[model samples]
Target: MPIPERFLDELMARTDIVDLVSESVRLTKKGSSYWGCCPFHSEKTPSFHVVPDRQIYKCFGCGKGGGAINFVMELENLSFWDAVSVLAKRAGMTMPESFGGSPDAQKRREKMLELNRRAALAFHRWLYAPEGAHGLDYLRRRGLSPGTLTRFGLGFAPDTWDALIQEMAKQGYDKRDLLDAGLAVSNKDGRIYDRFRNRVIFPIIDVRGGVIGFGGRVMDDSTPKYLNSPDTPVYNKSRNIFALNIAKKSKAGRVILTEGYMDTIALHQAGFDNAVASLGTSLTEEHAQLLSRYFKDAILSYDGDGAGIAAAQRAIPILEKAGLKVRVLRVTGAKDPDEFIKTHGRDAFARLLDKSENQVDYRLAQLQSKFDLTDDAQKVAFLQEAAQLIAARPSAVEREIYGGHAAQMAGITSESMAQEVSRALRHRLRKEKKQQERRDLAPAAQLQPKARSLRYDNIRSARAEEGVLRLLLLDPALLSRMDDLEGQEFSSPLLGRAFDALRGQAQQGLSPNLASLAQIFTGEEMDHLAQVASQPESAANGPRALTDYISIIRGEGLRRSQEQGDDLLLAMQKKYQKSKAYMEEKP
Candidate 1:
């Protein structure tokens, strides 16, 4: 059964959007709303606004917005019911016995989680069994202690293909479920088999400690050294990292990001509990945001090879953009963290961590390696690139400090480096200013939906439809003034569907709010609705404005139905004049 509308209304009323969003985003009061950098996307300016009056948030930069539930959904990467449950817990309300959403969807999600859990247990047991002797020998040889192996729920897949499939079947899970959970794969001959045969398994648990997926590493050199779970109903590799479940509670105060699961395990074993790694992928913006929620700083402990250095360079801006203070670790005399810890012992590894360089210095050192300081031309080339890098620093103090280091390295005066950086900064500013000017010249572009798939085809009709939605959201009672209109009258299908949904709620004596409508709308649709609600709508003139909007919509619907090409331009001009006249009266 679906959650009752009355219960949702009360839940939304009890939950404060400001308090919920403020926990993750630092918000500052700006007029009637609170503003902050968007968590959904990286932005320097405060384009994310939380409107306490409407109990919703809208990000002008990313075009993501919704009520508290939607905020939880986006920020936490949870489904609708899961997000609702989170908000319910926060508001101290008991979830209804049967939560809302498709029962099949909920069942499939629960089944996948349960199947992963069972498979993890089976794999763990197998690691200690005779069939997993090879896998066990590999981990022990790498200096992993028995307790460390157990703590991470480390396991081993037997060499045979159907070990997991057979084990799951005995537990009432079929081949289909195994495939859905990413535990098995199918071949061309219509045969199904395990996906992680002859590999040591690492269970990928979420922050909440649910086994959502798995990562497997081969004992010997293979074509693909590691195999990770494909994206499933419960797991997305780009959005999750290895060992974050344990790392989130670390008192170490920062996360040490490595490249592979073994390095993360080794660090944890050596008492650095905050170590994490991406699951067979490079660092992503989502990964950065997720890490930022737990740690304010991150140290990149990627390998010392060319690929690792390139990866670190790619990750620096993403982490910085997500508001994490980033530093780079250079593991000398060792290829990776696992090897470094094993060779020099834990204390020496700790010393290396303590001496990790900030991203600017690391980047400068990397650049220095590429050019010969003895050659004046190469030195000048190096300084030019260094000036651009230093100029990109958000802090003037950082730019000035790093500028001096680059100057000394190239045998130039500090003032000379500063001047070059200043020039670069000026060029960047001019470029940004011109871009802003272009945007300002096309003011209508800002009014369009951020998602290209949702853009309005008929601008004149969409504008009127937006006004109708804004007014209705401001005052559901104004829905009565829309008696002669129908949702199908709106030109845009998305807007029409929104109109129908909101009208249905108001007509049914329910408050027409985003929370009430969320169950029926997609995330993008909810974002668009929240954007509409955030727009200025006059309460006193809502009834009058609504009447005008309805006229425009109905007239457009009739004109569109007629398919008269000759009169199309004339009708559009008339609508424009009417809209212009209404806008002029708004003062």
Candidate 2:
């Protein structure tokens, strides 16, 4: 059931958007408003604003804006209803007791969380029981202290299909719920069983410290040695790092990103608590952006092998794009962090961390290793590849410093190398220009970024439609000024949808503000709404300004239809001028 409007009103009343956002983003007092780096998009400057009087936050960069609840939904990735429930809990208000029936997405999430907690408890107990003796012995042999095991919530699943299923059932959970939580798999015959059997379980935790999923390592020589929980309603593997829930709390300003759970566990047990790893996958853009939100630096400590080198190379651009200071950890005497920590001990590994090289140095070294500079042809080839790398640097100073190093290595002058790099930079710019030109040739492509759609036959019509929406948001009664404009008259679907929402609200005698519309729009749409609503306006000029905007919108509409024939376009405009139901649809 939907929550009561009064409750939501009270919830917002109790919540200060500036206080809520300040918990994550470092917002500074700027005049009457607060400002910070936008959470929605990557930017070096502060464009995100929180206005207390309006109780709305808007990012001028990515254009996302809304009240405190919408901020929570976007940042925490919760549903509108779920965000309300969370705020209700934080405010110490009870959910409406009569609001029970079937489970909504939020309720299902709560159930899944409870189920995972119980499953973790049962698995942890089983690791110490007689049935789990083999797993216990294995961990002991690997030198895992009792405290380390408890800290990580390490567990063992029995080598039977029904072990966890039967245990969870005894705790009042249904079999279907377990399957939905990705704890059990159903066969072709519809017989359900536990997903992980006879394996050591490592719980994957979110930054909030909830057990979202599990990663299992087989006890014996099994095929596909590691198995992870698939994407459930609660667990998305790509968005989380294995130990970030713990590492995010560390005083260390940087995080050590590794490959597997065991490597991360080993680093933590060895006093490197800031280490984290992805679950059975390579680094991703999501992972990079997530890490970017917390730490300014990341030390990638993948295995010291061929594949690991390639992986780190691929990950460098992604992490850099997310605005992180990245360095590569070169492990020696062992393949991975786990092996290195075991073989060299903690102090030696600490020395390696201090000696880690920045990404540019690592890349140059890797490329240099591929060629011997003594060969003239090979030196030219090396300089060409190295020049491209130098050209990719965002700063001219950085390119000069790194470019000189490359030039020296190739036994040439730095000025020669700079010329080569400059040529590459120009070539890259030209390529980008051509690609953008090709996109401009397609009218739909030009409209995609603005309208978030390509249905607009003309750019002028789309811009006018955008202007109309902005004016309506600023003064909702401007909607009355647009009584002759049909929802279908807007070329962009987003504008059309916004018009429809405004018409519905005006019809019902409720003012539709960003707060009221937060539940209705997607996060991107909210950003656009925020950007539009942020446009400077005045009450004195609102009506006259709205009339001008409406004229332009209608004029553009007629112009777009003129190719069909001027007579038809004029007749349509004449009818629209006299039309009263243009703001709403007729039955």
Best by TM-score: 1
TM-score of each: 0.85, 0.83
Model 2, range 427-462, lDDT digits (tens) per residue?
888998999889778875544444343345656666
Candidate 1 overall Cα lDDT vs. reference?
0.87
Lowest lDDT sum, 10 consecutive residues, model 2, at 578-587
Q: How much lDDT does candidate 2 score? A: 0.79
Cα lDDT tens digits, model 1, 476-542, are: 8776656546666688888888888777777877777777677878998889988888888788888
Output the lDDT of residue 476, model 1: 87
Backbone N/Cα/C clashes per model = 0, 2
Residue 34 CA displacement from its true place in model 1, Å:
3.7
> Candidate 1 versus the native: TM-score?
0.85
Q: Name the lDDT value of residue 347 in candidate 1.
A: 94
